[model samples]
Target: MDLEVGDKVSLIIGTETHLGFTVLIDESFEGLLYRNEIFEELKENQRIAGYVKNIREDGKIDVSLQPQGFRNAIELDTEKVIEAIYDHDGFLALTDKSDPEDIKKELRMSKKAFKRAIGSLYKQKQIVIGEEGLTLVKE
Candidate 1:
């Protein structure tokens, strides 16, 4: 395989299993995208971009919908949260305490990602974490 960890590739969504969705990578290699790593809806045969997460010694490959690495993934998730806040009129009814599924439905990101983004925003003074939710801090 000509792929390395973090390498971007084209993916065709395949069968869903108890573990996750199987994917055809770069139209040649077979890989698995874990269910727990997925946040958005995916259909069979759907085409999407993916990143190589790992390659087992046995030749099995692992893939991800988002770019690998903390910096790449966090930036994207953070932007999503910010956009959600704006879409909800400067207030997002999701806090660090929000359910994982709710955060996934609202931001299409995992709870860990949401918390990291929110924390980043808070440190930057870009948003306020309130009992009700997150409020955008006006400039």
Candidate 2:
């Protein structure tokens, strides 16, 4: 296989399964996009960018919609959170104490990622965390 772990590839959504969605990678390889790793809705025959997450010993490929590694994930997630805040009139009703499910529903990301992004924003003075949630700090 020409694909290696972390390789970016084009994916064509195939079928939905109990575990996740089956996809065709670069129109040649079969891969699985696990449900837990998915954050957005996907439809059959839809094409999207994906990263090679793993290649099992048995030849099954695991793919992800997001890039691998903490740096990449953090940057992307941070931007997403920032954008969400902007979209919501600079106030996001999500705090550290917010329910994980609520955060996931609102942000389509894990609570941990939300926390990290909020923390970064706080450090940069880009946002303020309060009893009401996250408020974008106006410059």
lDDT of 1 by residue, 44-97 (tens): 999999999999999999999999999998889889989999999999999999
Give candidate 1 regions above 4 Å deviation.
none
Residues 1-139, candidate 2, lDDT per residue (tens digit)?
A: 8889989999999999999999999999999999988877899999999999999999999999888888888889889989999999999999999998988899988888889888888998999999979999898
Which regions of candidate 2 fall more than 4 Å away from where they truly are?
none
TM-score of each: 0.96, 0.91
Worst 10 residues of 2 by lDDT: 66-75
Clashes of each: 0, 0
Q: Rate the local accuracy (lDDT) of all candidates.
A: 0.94, 0.92
Error at 17, model 2, angstroms: 1.4
Q: Please state every model's RMSD to the true fold in angstroms.
A: 0.9, 1.4
